[model samples]
Target: MNRKRSRGKNPWRCSHRYPLRRRRRATPGRSRGDPAVDPEDPEQDPDDGNAPPSDDDEDDDEAGPVVTTTHRRFDYPPPVPRMPRETLEMLHYDQFWITYVGTRYRHPALPDDWDMTVEISIPDEFGSRQNIHVRHAPTRRNSHEAAISDAAREALTTLCHAHREDMAITSRRYYPCRSVERLDAWIANPEAEQNPRLESTIEYLATLNTDYNAALDELDMVRYENRKLRAWVAHGVEPAEEEPVEDPADAPRRKKARYNDPEARTYIRHHED
Candidate 1:
C-alpha cells in the first residue's frame, strides 16, 4: 500500500502549489568547491555570474598567431603604358629594314590632322645621319597605322629600286635577289594591296635589318685600329721618316755658260792657246 500522502510543503506531494520548471544541475564550467563571484564587484561581469577564472597565459598559448592581411589588386589591370610622341630611330642596313617600323607606340599629336609617326636615320661616313621623315593621315580603317604603313611602302619601294644596283654589289647573304625580285614583281603587279602575305613578308624580311648591325660595323673598325696599334707597340715598330728636300735657293750657282757670252768664249779659247 502507498504511504498516506503527507500534506507538507513538498512539490512532490503537492503539485498544485508549485509551478513546473527545469531542475538546475551542477555546471560543467564551474565546480561546487569554487567561490561564487559577487555581482557588485567591479572586476567581475554582472551577467557572467558562473564564469570560471582562466589564466591569461593558457588562453594565449591555445590561441593561434594573429595574422593581418594587406589586400592588393593583382586581378585589376594596370594603366596603359606611356608612348613617345615621336621617335628617331635608324632603319635598314639590311634588306626589308623598312619593316622594322610598327604601329605600336604611335602618338597622334594631331588626332584630326596628319602626323609624322616616326623618322628613320641612316648614318654616313662623316658621322652625319640622313633622316627620312614618314608622314601619315588617320583614316576610318585603322587611323594612322595603315597610312604610316602605306607611306613606308611608297618610300621603301623607291629606295629598294634605287638601291638595287648597290644591293647587287654588297653581300646580301640573308636577303636573296629572288626575294627582292618577287617583292618587286608583287609591287609592280599592284597585287600586294590585296594580299596580306606581302605585308607579312615585309615584316618577315625586316627582321634581318637593325641599327645594331651598323654599330657592329663601327665597333669592328675600332677594334681593327686598336689591333694595328697594339701590333705596332709590341713590335717596337716606328714609322719611317720622310727624306727632307734641299732648298733650290741653298744650292750653289751653276758656273757661267761660255756659249752664252762671246767674251767668255774668247777668253776660254785664249787660255787653251
Candidate 2:
C-alpha cells in the first residue's frame, strides 16, 4: 500500500519559493501616443520638461566690480572772523593780563569775571624805552564785582594812554616823509644804503613790530646784565672791577656757630683773633 500511494504536492512550499512580481511604473502621456522615457536616463527632466530653471539651479558667473559714491559737504561750522591787526595787538597785550593776573584772581567755579592788568616795557636801539599797559575785564559775577569793575575801568583807561604812547614811539622811530619826492630822495641817498642796520631798524619801527619789541623787552635788568656778561665772555673780555669772585681760602671761616649761646659773640671774636 505504501508503494502504490499517489505523489503528494506541497502548495505552501511552492508559494514560498516564487514570490509576487512588482508592478511597472506608468509613463506620462504614453497612453496618448507620446514617447515613453527610460527611468534610469541621465538627460531626463522631472517636470513636464517645459519650465525654466530657478535661481538656485542657475550657475554663478564671475563677480562684478564694486561701485562707490561720495558727498563733499563740510562737517564743521565756519571759522570765526579774526580781529584787525591793531585790535589783535591790543588783544595780545591783554592776553598777558589773562595769563598772569586773571589766573590768580579768577574764581574756581566761574572764571569769566577776572580782572587783570600787565605792564610791559621795551627799549629800542636809540636808547628810548616804550611802556605798554594791558587790562582785562572780569567775566564772572562776584561780591567784589563793583570794586573790580572800577579798577578794570581805570586800568583800561591807562591801557589806552599807554597804547597812544607806544604809537608815538613807533612813529618817532620811523617818521613818514612829507612827499613821495622826499621818500625817493631818502631812498636814493648813499648814506641810507651804507647804514643798512639803521634803515632796517627804522623800517621795523615804522611797521610797529609790537610782538618783536615785546619779546625783546621781556628781559629784565638782571637778565640783560647776564646776557651782556655772557657776550663779553664769548669775546674773551673781562668783566668790570665791580664784579668780584671770592677766593676759596680767603672766605671767612665759621666761628662758634651756636644758635643760642650767650657768649657766642665773644667766642667768635676770639676765633677771629
TM-scores, all candidates, are: 0.21, 0.16
Candidate 2 residue-wise lDDT, 43-119, digit = tens? 87433322222223322211111111111111112111111123225445432111112212221122222222222
Candidate 2: residue 122 Cα off by (Å): 2.7
Model 2 residue 185 distance off true place after TM-score fit, in angstroms: 42
What is the Cα-based lDDT of residue 65 in candidate 1? 17
Q: List the residue pairs that clash in candidate 1.
A: none
Candidate-wise lDDT, in order = 0.27, 0.27
Per-residue C-alpha lDDT of model 1 across residues 137-212, encoded as one tens digit per residue: 1111122334344334333333334444543333321131212112121112213257777645544443332222
Candidate 2 wrong stretches, greater than 4 Å: 1-100, 104-113, 123-156, 162-273
lDDT of 1: 0.27
Question: Candidate 2: deviation at residue 77, Å?
Answer: 16
Question: How high a TM-score does candidate 2 get?
Answer: 0.16
Best by the TM-score measure: 1
Best by lDDT: 1
